[model samples]
Target: MSHHSKAKQLLQQRDELDEKVKELLLVLETNNSTMDSPLVDAEGYPLNTIDVYAVRHARHDLICLRNDRAQWTEKIVEEMEQDEEKMGESAPIEEKPVHRTSNEPFVKVSSVVELSPADVGGFRKEDLIIQYGNLHHGNFKNMQQVAEITKEYENKTIRVTVIRDHRPVRLEISPKKWSGPGLLGCNIVPIAGANV
Candidate 1:
């Protein structure tokens, strides 16, 4: 996500919390007797201070929750991202490419020269179909179509149209392939405008 978009979301969340804080403050500051909702103490008389402190506690909790959200949503995303980059460089052993599950949209091909090594890892012929990437068919259609396009693209750039949950959408996935295996050894799903 872009910095501007994140800033906008944080600003909106902060504004909403501020409005809630103001509303709670107004309710606590009220001196009218009729607004009391039968709240009573040991003596059976209405407890005004009791209600005041309750609202105060709620306001305090809201403030704490907002602070926690700011710490995680604003300050933590960048730090975690940096950690990921550092980890990527300093790993102890040679890394192997990990392919997504059949349930996801990602695709991969084995290295032709190192086909045995790639095959020994995790990829399999049955694991090659492109589907919604960790998403269901109904929540959104466009991304599922992306999966279809990714599969069909194989090692060449291509466009595709797919019916996700009965809605049609178009997507284009970049051309990426394993030259060693010479076409990834998987039968790619055919989509629109494909040369078959």
Candidate 2:
């Protein structure tokens, strides 16, 4: 396969695997934090023993998936670099900032406060905010742009586009006054300025 196609495939696979890992981690956390062990059954039945083996099995799977994803990501970066080198040799082109593509720019979620609008909206750490309502990719030049856009739509449900685990996800977020430090209760840093 071509370098670009291969890279794209790897990226998609890595993203999917990353998402699965995250979900599995959450499941592990839930299972581990229980006050008392409870049996999980696919159908209603006499309670079966919830064993440590199930959690251990999930943990093992998560580790293997993460390791595979890391290796694939390394391959993708190498392939991308090779493609860039070939393009540069063919013609002179200005190097641009990474993550600031022609597509919608994204912001990385740096922190999220508990019980905040962001938490309610299901925003997670490392989520990439791609669009906020009408704010297109080119419309954002800095982190402040995102804050302003959210403020404008405060108390209203707004459609938000985000890149989570390398996949595009649409979420309806309503930024409003809550018992938190801010309306959204989340901190987002500009991706263009970050190492990622």
Question: Per-residue lDDT for 76 in model 1?
Answer: 30
Runs in model 2 deviating more than 4 A are: 1-101, 193-196
Give me the displacement of residue 60 in model 2, in angstroms: 33
Alpha carbon lDDT at 156, candidate 2: 74
TM-score of each: 0.26, 0.46
lDDT of each: 0.40, 0.67
How many residue pairs clash in each candidate at the backbone level?
Answer: 2, 0
In model 1, the Cα lDDT at residue 160 comes to: 26
Alpha-carbon RMSD to native, per candidate: 16.5, 13.2
Best by TM-score: 2
| Model 1 steric clash pairs | 112-180, 112-181
Q: Model 1, residue 23: displacement in angstroms?
A: 21
